[model samples]
Target chain A: MRQTILSISNLSKTFGGVVATDDLSLDVEQGELHAIIGPNGAGKTTLIAQLSGEIFPDNGRILFQNKNITMLPPFKRSHLGIARSFQITSLMQGMDVIDNVALATQANDGHAYKFWKPARDDRDLRQSAIDALKEVGLEGREFEKVQNLSHGEHRQLEIAMALATQPHLLLLDEPMAGMGTEEGDKILKILQKLKKRKTILLIEHDMDVVFALADRITVLVYGRAIASGSPQSIKTDERVREAYLGTEGDLNC
Target chain B: MRNLLTRKSFNFAFIISVGLLALLPLYVEMTGDDFYLDLANRLMILAIAAVSLNLILGHGGMISFGHAAYLGIGAYSVGIPAYYEIYDGLFQIITAVFVSGVFALLTGAVSLRTKGVYFIMITMAFTQMAFFGIVSIEEYGGDDGLVIDTRSTFGNFFDLEDTVTLYYFVFVSLLISLFIVKRIMESRFGMVISGSKSNERRMQSIGYNTYRYKLVCYVLSGCLCGYAGALLGNFTNFISPEMMDWTASGELIFMVLLGGSGALLGPLWGAASFVLLEEWLSSITTYWHFFFGALLILVVLFARGGIDGLLSKIGLSK
Candidate 1:
């Protein structure tokens, strides 16, 4: 029996009469790889924003670990075991990969305000950051700064940062967005491995990756949850076909 | 080992520079050049101010244009208490920091709402407002400036009335500010600021409340600047509303840009260069402001990251 780790109830967000999310409700089960699939501007990013506490919905309730957390700040949400990776690669361009990952680890540690002892000297935090880097197959690239890393490597580093938080649920936005087929396959392998331990809410446009990995898929169109179910069910839904996945559908998730 | 050598070279250069500066007062004393010591003292004080700005601008990626206002506030922190006959040095310094900190917190909360150039403009506007408010105080010297009647006393711990002692005091304050900033910039909050500077929206999605992080940096920067201002008041034996003016703020910002915003030692270099340039220019020509202003414009136009950025680009920077 899979328990729900997060539950969104009747959530809606609008920006100046443009509805971003409309009466959306969903439950993310523990240890499940649930993917949210939609065309561009389908409120997917907005939903992620609200879930991650970056944006507040006009009306909604977010329950995480049986606690109401709609108004919680992003860091608090992260502390409570919800970690997210951005669609756009966002890493400190000046700092090395290990330093970046160690920063994320520092977030959950007792006090980042302690300034005298060098963070590098702390073996425990350093080891965890190293462990996260190795988990993402970025072991040897620890000393490389984000700017020097390839685009695929930046994406991989994003995952490594998310893992450093020791999150129970990883909300990954477009992990394979800019990757080539080879790079995509590499990420798919990483996601496959991660799914075994962490409950993941993946937002991806690649239907093949979506269908291959998502134990359940939710299709969103024009800020509405048009259809949701198994990949086979969503592929056959008529409303979803009209809203998206019809003749003009290119799966720009 | 090359990295170790580079680091050692940086330390050596820093020590040499400080040694040279410490000996400057002796030259002034021997040559009867009061102006030289005065200018050097001004540079040291501004260097302290610039170091604080570096905490926010370099480490946090917050390009605050109004850091000078904190200096103004800090000057008043000392000036106000002394005017009221409450001239305890430590108390005045504490008050200065508290006032500036509160101001920064409130302003940062509103200003940090916008990012990029918008943040800079909002901060600049707030500082101007502070400047104007001080100017409007007719009883407190208003537009003219307030003259301190007595030197701030620290329970006979040191004689600030002695110019040489005061110079060393300013030097020690600069060192302490640098030490504190170095620690804060290397801490976890510092990491968050660095991360947010790269990508704030990404930070949000990762569950870091970047707004709060930025606010903290702003307040810290303001408090340190206040310390500089209080020291400036004691060094000058006067305080003026002009200390809070936009030009003063702009010059401090220029110091940051000229030295290197990111490097710890950059602002000190910048302050030294800026004060020396002004002194030299004034000696050479009466129209020094015009010439110096033109040179500064050129620096801003051609030098993207100031002298430090330029050196780093050419592989000469630390």
Candidate 2:
């Protein structure tokens, strides 16, 4: 039996009168690549926000390694090994690619109050960043400024940044969103490799990638989980088809 | 723009500026131009204060409009003690650093919680408060200010009596301030502060408590500016509520931006330009400030990195 690495129960959040997350509960086992998919306004990103501690849920309990982390701040959650990539492509636009990843690596290293020695000269930090960049196929472009990188490169950098944290669970909010087929395929390959070693809770809109990558799939509609199971089970669920998946003819597989 | 200024022209501009400052005393001694030496002394002190401002304002991306309050606090550290015959330079320097550091810690704690225009307003309000607080104090001479009968004395270390001695003292302080700012920016602490300025959310999500880093930087900046104030008090031989005025703080900000806010040597250039322009323009006309204001507007309109930006682009092209 696989151990549950992350557990969320009765998670709920609201903005004014609109229910962004309505009594949502989910769980992912160790090393499982769980995918959450839905149409627009399905609260997928909102759910990721709560999990990453960007915003607190109205009511819920989040257990990471059996520790309650629901009220923890974002940085504290990061320290606990929960890393996230934003849907809007958030990064330090001023810094270069390697330094960006190096900063993320430095974050998890230890206290940063060392106000004398140069951080850029630390061999261990730079090496770890290089390793993460190489993993994301961004090795040769380490010196490139983030502002000059293409959108696809930005996504790759985003993944590299998440990986540099050495996180146990990566909450990737649409890693392949707005990418061309070539870029999307690169991300798919990276995710395929990552799934073997890390537990990733991904939110993606591409059904083919979802069905192709996720070990387990959860269908969300209007902030509620309508269906969650293996790929074949979710593909046939009547409620999921009516609410989100649509006709089986569109599955294309 | 990365280091608050481009690195391209840094070598060219910084070396030239420092060389000139280093040779100024010898030139003055040979030419017997004591007036110019005095002017350079005042210029360097303000430069030290501006450099301290640049640390938080430029690299750390914290806009503090109330930095001059620390200047007043530092000056008063000397003025008040000297009034009662406490002339130990060690006590004065420590008081300047400790008192201003504490003040920054308290005010920065409140100021840093805000952002954008509100941050500017709240900081200005604090300076106004400090200004009025001193104005209302009768024992410190209120608006009339205080005159120090005897300058601060160090125990056989160095005396601040002679203008030449004071000039060297101020010069060394300026260099030290620049060195400190440079070291801090390259340090691990500097990286976090710069990262926080770039994308604070990213910094937090990456597991850094950015608030604490920024607070420490703010306090350090305040302490350095306070030391500059102590030197200012000694130079003018006076202390007054006028030292902490919001306008004085605004001038400091102007110097930072005019020189190039983030570049290591930007403040030095800014303070030099301000002093020279003020002196030259006033000598030419009674309304010389009109021309100075116009010149500043022109620089703002034309220069991207202020003086640093223009020079870097030139350096880039060549």
Candidate 3:
């Protein structure tokens, strides 16, 4: 049996009167691509936020490698090898692409208190950033400003930055949220390659990509998990079909 | 090469300006006008303060409205010593830096906890507190302010009393400060600070403890400004609560914005233009502030990047 890398027990969060996440529990095994699917307002983002420490759950425990990390801040969680890509493409827009990724590499490599030598001159850091970019198929676009990149490229850069941190588990929120079929295919190929080496917890709206990539799927509806099973089982699960896939329409395409 | 020069003209403009400052003493001597020398000295000293403010206000995106408090602290570090008949230049300098650094550490620790408009208000409140505290010190001239009997002595190694010598000293100090600020901004520490400014949430999520980085920057900026305060106190031969007034802090912010905010030499240009405009306008009429205010409004409306931005437009600056 595969060892569990992440386990959530009794997770709960509420914003005002709205229940964003409710008494949710799930397990993600090492080296498995776990996909969390839900309808709009299903708290998929909220669950990712709590897991990444951006939002604290009202009540819950998050265990990573058997260590309780529910109370830790986002940076501490990042240090413990949890890197997240935002749904809104949270990148340093004014900075060059390479510098953005380089900063991520710098963040995890050592203490960022070095004040004498120029960071651009650090070959190891730059090389690691370049490698991350190369993995995302953005090798030649390093010097371009992030704001100038296409929306699809921004998503790729987001993944590159997350990858640059060398995290054990990648938390991607809507990586293909607004991508065209061509752009989606590019990202799908990159994720396919990544699945061979890295464990990713993805929140996706595209059923084709979800069914294609996910090893185990967790269906969420109104902040509560409806089912957790393999992709084939999740596709045909009576509750998942009624709650999410029934409304999604024509998943076989 | 031409394209490169145009693109990097800001650097060119900076070097030319510094070179002109270096030759101002010669111009003063040749024209038999010593008053210009004093004005130039004031410009360089204020430039130091402006440059320090830029580190937080421009680069770190922390709008601190009480930066002049460090200047006051720095000046008092020298003034309080001289009032006690202690005239050691090295001792005064050390005390000024240490006091200002500690002040920054303590104030930044508290003020940095609050952000946006609250940060500005909190910083202003701290400066006002310092100003009022200084005003209560009746022995140090209270509301009237204190006068230095003699310029700081450097163990007979140098004379700050000589105008030419003092000019060079302030000039070299400005160069050293620019070097230090530039180096820090290019380093890893600078990346974190700048990154935090761009997107603070992203920085935190990327495993950077942005608070510590920002606090360090605040303290560093404060200490540098405090050093400038020491120089200002010596140059004027006076230290006053007026130096730490909220208006004084506002002027420093204006200087940073009046020049391009993020550029290293932006504050230097801002200080020069501001002081020069003040001198020229005040010579023509008593209501110089009206014209200064109008000019500032115009700059804000048209040249959003300040003098540096305008120069860059004309292919004369970086």
Candidate 4:
């Protein structure tokens, strides 16, 4: 049996009287690409936020590597080998791509308060940031400002930044939100390549990408997990069909 | 080489300007213009204070409107010590830095919790509170302020009593501060700060405790401003509640904005130009503040990036 790296046991959250995430429990094994697919406003982003320590769940707990990380801040979770990429383009737009990723790398390293010594001169950090950029196929574009990059390139840079943290598990929210077919295919190919070495919990809207990438699929409907299974089982599940797919399943996917 | 110079052009300009300033007093003495030397010394003190403000407003992205409170604290540091006959120069400077840092910590803790305009308002409110508090201190000259009979001395090792020596002293202190600010801005922590300014939400997500980082920068900026306050007190032979006034705070902001807040040296230039303009305009008319205020308005509206921005536009910045 594959060992679980992240276990969300009965996690629940409520804002005022509305339930944002209701008694949701799921497990992601080590080295698996788990997909959480749902419609808009299905609490997909909120669930990812809770996992990455952006928000705290109202009930139950989250265990990472068998240790409770229920109350850790986003940065603390990042230090403990968990990294996340924002759904929106949240990079330092004025700075170069290499520098953006370097910010993440610098955080996990020793004290950043050392004055008089230039951060760029640190060979290890510079090389690692470059290497991570290369992994996302951004090798030739390291010096370019992030604001100048295309939407597709920005998405790639976001993934590259998360990769630079040298995360054991990557939490990506809406990686392919706004992309053309070619761009989507480019990211799909990259994620396909990365799946071999890293564990990923991806929240995606594209059914095709989710089905293609997810080793295990978890369906969330109105903040509740309706079904959990392999992509093949999920495609055939009646409850999932009624809740998410409905009559327009063939047209949408 | 041109790209490299442009990257740190503000610093290069600062060095050249300082070199010119060092030779200025000699030219003034030759021409029998002692008044220009006095003006130079005054500008130097304001430059020192503005440079400190740049650390927070420019580099740290914490737009504080109450930074002059530290200047008041620093000035009082010298006055209170001198009034009590504790006139050691080094000791007075040390006390000023400590008091300013403590004030920064207490005020920044409360103000930093809310961001944007709220932060500005909170800082302004605190500065007003300090201004009023000083006014109510009837023992220390109250609303009129206090004066020190003698400038501080370094335990008889050196005397800052001479005008020529003091001008050089203030100039050199500004130089040292420029170097320190430059060093701090290039470090790894500096990268995090710049990163936060560009995208704070991303920095927080990437594991940086931004609140702590901003607070450190705030305290460091305040301490540096206090050093300037110490020098100003000795130079003028007086300290006043006017140093903590809201207009004084606004002037600091204007200095940072006018010089091109993009680089540290810009604030120094901004301070010098502003003080010199005030001196020149006041000679022509007593209501010089109206013109200065109008100029600032123009800078904000048209020259959004300030003097450095204009210099860069004309291909002269580097």
Pick by TM-score: which candidate is best? 3
Screening candidate 2 with a backbone cut-off below 3 angstroms (N, C-alpha, C), the clashing residue pairs are: B4-B262
Task: Quote the positional error of residue A28 for candidate 4 in Å.
Answer: 1.2
Comparing 1 with 3 on DockQ, the higher-scoring candidate is 3
TM-scores vs. true structure, each candidate: 0.90, 0.96, 0.97, 0.95
lDDT of 2 by residue, B235-313 (tens): 9898999999998998999899898888888888899999998899889899987886787788778884777777777
User: Candidate 4 — which residues are off by over 4 angstroms?
Assistant: B1-15
Off by over 4 Å in 1: A14-20, A232-244, A247-253, B1-9, B84-87, B114-118, B136-138, B311-317
DockQ of each: 0.45, 0.59, 0.62, 0.64
DockQ of 4: 0.64
Error of 1 at A178 (Å): 1.7
The residue-by-residue lDDT of candidate 4 on A186-249, one tens digit each, is 9999999999999999999888898889999999988999999999898888888888878546
Q: Which segments of model 2 are wrong by more than 4 Å?
A: A245-249, B1-10, B316-318
Cα misplacement distance, residue A137 of candidate 1 (Å): 0.8
Task: List the lowest-lDDT window of 10 residues for candidate 1 chain B.
Answer: B1-10
DockQ of 3: 0.62
| CA displacement after TM-score superposition, residue A73 of candidate 4 (Å) | 1.9
Interface RMSD of 1: 3.3
Candidate 4 lDDT by residue in tens digits, B21-109: 99987898799878888888988889889989988888877889998998898898999888898889998999999989999999999
Docking class of 4: medium
lDDT of 1 by residue, B137-199 (tens): 898888888888787788968657777788888988888888888777666677778888887
Q: For residues A57-83, what per-residue lDDT tens digits would candidate 3 score against the true structure?
A: 989899999999998999999999999
